[model samples]
Target chain A: MSTYRVVPAGSVFDRFAKHIFILPGLGVLVALVIYPTYYLIRLALSNFDLTFMTKPVFIGLGNFIQILSDTYFWGALGNTLVMASIAVALEFVFGLGMALLLNEDLRGGRIIKSLLIVPMMIPPVVVGLNFKLIFDQFGPLNDLLQRLGVSCVDWLGNPLMAKVSVILADVWQWSSFMFIIFLAGLQAIPQYLYDSAKVDGASGWRTFRFITWPMLVPSATVALTFRVMDALKIFDVVYMVTSGGPSFSTEVLSLYIYRTGFRFGTLGYASAVAVIMLILLTAIIEVIIKETRLGKRLEWE
Target chain B: MKVKSKYVKHCLHYMLICSALVFYLFPIYWLIITSLKFPGDVTASPVVWFTTKLTLDNYRLLFGHTGALWGAKQYVGRSFLPSIAPYITNSIMIGVLSSGFGLLLGALLAYGIVRFRIGGSRLYNWLLSLRMIPPVVVAIPMFTVFRTLGLIDTWWAVASAHLLMSIPFSTLLLIGFFSDIPGDIMEAALLDGCTNLGAFSRVVLPLAAPGLVAVFIIAFLTSWNELLIANVLTTTAKAQTFPVYTTSFAQVERGTAWGPAAAGGVIGMVPMLISSFYIQRYLVRGLTMGAVKE
Candidate 1:
């Protein structure tokens, strides 16, 4: 066998090589990210509407003050929180149930997993449009309801139902995401732990609570964090289905921002709303990461 | 009694799994059937679950073959309903270019961090935070910058914005992959007179090929499926991606063209549906940004 040789630590290549690999990519990203953040803050503190024939006039705390009293802003924020909490909660429950069921010794499990992936893989626009059809007045869902001797519900026309419809569409697409993550978490637990639990005469519930739940916390935190972040940014589905309709009952933050900036041409005010959203999301995520110790669990150390 | 209970439980398990499958798949099925139905039959009161009178008129309209359709008179002046071909091309070009560039930069960055411990844990936290920034926040300011630069309605504009998404994601994923590569292999390559860059390109890259492909496909899908950034940056079919094109069907004054929209949705979803199957093994890692290793 040939003896192994070691490269010298003080080689010519070693001194400057890391910088070459790291700087270009990092520099491009930081520059791109930083400029927009700077511009966003500047835009937030000004009056920049496309309708007016004037440059952006800097007005300190003006947009923020306006937001404080704007009913629409509060309504949109409320709607966003409501939709995200309900949708993510439902997704988590259904996803956990499905993951538990799937972890059993069932035949054709592989095929089922592949099929489960189809929903989350489809584009959100497509999912939104498809759900819109299903929830339409004369669509399949209403027809099925009528056959069962129930009056057809105006799914998108009513404020509450429109919110429910939007949430349903989101749950349908994203429950699979939680399912996939939780399933991975479940599988990662060693089989011997379950066997030992069984030897101690522990029931299924106890086995899960004592052994599985604690082991799955890291995965749950990751999955929940990702889903919560996504749920907060809900736009395509709401835009396609309701356009935040029925008197803005389902107007999420992202849709609100889009309409304000693009439709109403209030770039400055929209930027202010967007800045608030960013800070709120960052704060929520920081709490999650800290409380769950997800940063450490993620091997970031 | 015990054996009977076990059998009952197994049956219950099968039933649950079957129903779950139906729940997940029914919407996709509904999309396809609706796309194939005649315009009148599409909204029939009883809901035409299946029809032998299936027609490709929706597809024809979406493809801009309206000149030959029987009711061509109705679509005469509707200039907004253009062929989806150009938008599809735009999406393909943008997805490929953005993800391709993202993979290059992200892979290099990931290698440096994993191998040399370039930035440490603080950098990792920063990258994760970047991933969490909502798209609307970025889109707002980028719109003004792009408009000023006259880059609005160009593929590069959308592609560059998508790079904001793809780079952090791909880097995070590649960091996981690069960490998995054995250090001894790289050392051996260096001992054999391979330069640092040479070892990465020739040895580390080949070993991590699967992970790279996985990252590229995911990044491609992210850019491809993205709507907000693409919508803000593109005003017309010149650089509009497929999702933007699909959303054009929703005209407020005149009711939405459901049939054609369904067809557009189908066409937009086909590539991803196919890719979903191809990348099944990597789905967990890719979706979770390597938080969950398969």
Candidate 2:
């Protein structure tokens, strides 16, 4: 940082070099993020005639209005929220438990830790497609249940189970991510904390509640916030597995937008949906980010 | 008494580990099993049980007979071909190109940010915020933009879109890496014949090799596994990736061809799974970077 360059003022090459990357970087940001967002909003507010692409009509809030009155939109929103809420909560509890287990000095812990991250590494579409096969009427899930002398229930066939099935797949892949974060946090806490607590006559439960839970919240917050944001935008799994389902039961917001834009060619409606999703997600993420290290802890990591 | 307490602790840890192993590994195990089974036998073994026969056809088909991907039959378009093979190649190509490009761009920007103290730090943090924003939010908008630009269904389109996540993640990691290289050392480089860029390219970069390598692998893996945008943006094999290759198995008439799809799924993930576990240390370091101070 203290390095001084004494190039004369007339050295245009160095001057260009100094500021060269700035404009290119800005250009990249706009092209990659800002422009696409702009065009999407434009399309959402515009008119699309089939024969000829119509001049974009300025229908103020009309698309949002249609979205508001549409029952499918509401259903999609509800399903998306339910999926995120359930998946995130499950991942938190499940991931916390998994982290605790992996932290143990067990013979198979390494193998288990390696195995745990396998699901997340799989492509999301494949995860959805794989689950699609698993959830079939005579799919392995049912066959397995039948083997246990229990009657098989319709998985994707039923409205509720479809959502539950996708949630389960998400929890399967991502709980490990949460676990990794918590494990890191746990590793950061000195072993002596537990030893000290024991010396102070703190019961195991008391030590866990006071030491583990409180100390781990910052890490938990990072993991949970990430999972929650991702779960809301859950598309690949839903789109690949159900394509919004037997009765549109599994159509989260992203799926709805995907269908609206690509399948039906309703660019404006899809754009509006996309924008709403972005705005809503941004608001939620901003709040969640507050609890994360970036906003709260204020460190590079 | 101390020995007894240690024994109880060990027992508790064992109990927790066993239950977690079973629960966490079940679904993935089921996927692998299903991939190895034929359609009829997919459910023949209990939902979570092992089947008597294990076949390798699913894995075989994706590796496909033809190397360059030729058309078996004429379809709607002038030159529609069997996508399964080409799709794999396309995915690999896109993954390599995008991640390669992303790494270069991310590293250079991260270097400038870290070394020169070029821009406001908040802007750098905001980039991390973008990293956190789910791709779904950007996917739809970008889909429209790409479509308009005639870049839809192209490799570059997908690659550029990936920058949205890769840049910020790379910067965040690189910032920590660069900062860890004490200011005194960078100043020493300037005292030599090294310009900021030269010093960065020659000295700082080599020093940050571990971080760069970790970032490269992660970026590559993410691009390889990406599905949502790829599925929407690309309709044909020309730009489609392996992740979406299985979706084509779902013909409107057929409910879903589980055998081929699961087989494809397995093929696609195997490379990633193998490398990740082998490089698990780097992956963990990459993920948990910025976490601990040097």
Candidate 3:
């Protein structure tokens, strides 16, 4: 019985040995994360401009008050929500369709599946640059449209089209990510469930709705949460393609913070915006976790 | 009747798959072809779908060996333009070091969590939340701190920032891999008179090699492709990455030099393209933060 015990109980060295494995990693992570976060909070509460050589001037809640009155901040916040929702919704639909199609176990499926991963694997900056070329005035897309007797529309120049183009680029790159996740979910489903469903003579749609859909909830939650989180921080694509576009119609919150802090030299106000963004993200994700009961599923045994 | 119906369904599935592939592959195809085209052919009307006149002038221009005088002259006064070689070197150096360090730490942390149950679910949740924090939020303060330490524009500044981003993600990923390894193996090693560190290195690390590879690739790629933190931390070619250099084309005032930019984009995408093929099996597991294991 004593030999069967895995947790050592003999010596002081044995008692403290476990901490050795974790302390180095966790210590580095904590040290790296804690200081910036602390400084970020401190900067958020002060007036620290990069352009000025003077020390920060502490101002209580002033930046937050200014944020409340700033229409640009509100517009950027609105754009972030709208873009994330629309792009994620489209990605979910297209990804699910792709997953279902690929799940059929057709001939040459492996090749097609590997090819599908290409867009998602490439850098977001490259995706943006690729789309920028394709959306150019005389590029392939416009030529194709013109050949089809449709007019060539300005893609990045017009504000509405710029938003549409950004969403399109995002969907093009990320739909494959959702597809991969859903496909994994689909594969994880036991074949016996379908076998039993077939014995009962259930229709395909009914089997999917009752069996597949319910089984797929966990994967859907993960894909949606990650995609939404990533879409909210959509600076690279927008930075390359539109740079917040023709009259700032596509300036999402992350890009807004970048412009404020780096471009315009207003570190304190940008830090305030960033703090707000962090809180909003945490709150939204918490609601999502609670609503989906993902927290329950994420627990360790 | 059932056989015919199955045939029709197969046809429908093939059609859908083909169309989706076309939608996904066309832009990539365009990017590659544009890189091979001359400036005139790139913007040519009718889209120049097939040009026998494909040129590597863009590549030559990017490598700074353009024998074409005009291409050389176009970039003569552009001091801000980055030479592609040094930036690529910087990216590789930073990516390898940061992700390497991230893997070492993450593996140990994951091992501790799986075996000792040190932090449990609460700690796991905190790590997950750390992964969710926006890069911009971290970028501002990291910039300030690095500057104060006089570490700005060095590889260390960018690599350390990237390490912060990679650690949580790598730990989360490695946790799934470590959990899959049965505890009996560790117990067996311990019963053989091995210390915890010895058992971890000799027995566990070998078993987790595939997972470690996958995590390293993903972490390296994340650092390689990252722009916001890297952009904030490094200003000169001394430590800037390929993505930062690629973005400079977008900022070129006279209008983007699409040919050279496309060439650079193609170069930047090659490693990931090759890596995707190698890691296809592990990608779903890695990308979802190990939530959905295949």
Off by over 4 Å in 1: A1-14, A298-300, B70-80, B252-256
TM-score of each: 0.96, 0.89, 0.95
In the range B1-294, model 3's lDDT, one tens digit per residue, is 999999998788788889999999998888898899877787777789877778787777787773553455655523444459998999999999899999999998888888787786678777877878899999999999989999999999999899887888889888888877887898898887777777789998999999899899999999989989989999998999998888877776422588788889999987898788768889988887777788
DockQ per candidate? 0.70, 0.44, 0.66
Ranking by DockQ: 1, 3, 2
Best by DockQ: 1
As for candidate 1, its interface RMSD to one decimal place is 1.8
Q: Is candidate 1 or candidate 3 better by DockQ?
A: 1
Q: Please give, for residues B197-232, the per-residue lDDT of candidate 2 as tens digits.
A: 667788888988887877877877888888777777
Poorest 10 consecutive residues by lDDT, candidate 2 chain B: B69-78
Q: Stretches of candidate 3 above 4 Å error?
A: A1-15, A298-300, B1-7, B69-81, B253-256
The TM-score of predicted model 3 comes to 0.95
Local error of candidate 2 at A230, Å?
Answer: 0.6
Which candidate, 2 or 3, has the higher lDDT? 3
- Please tell me how candidate 2 rates in CAPRI terms: acceptable
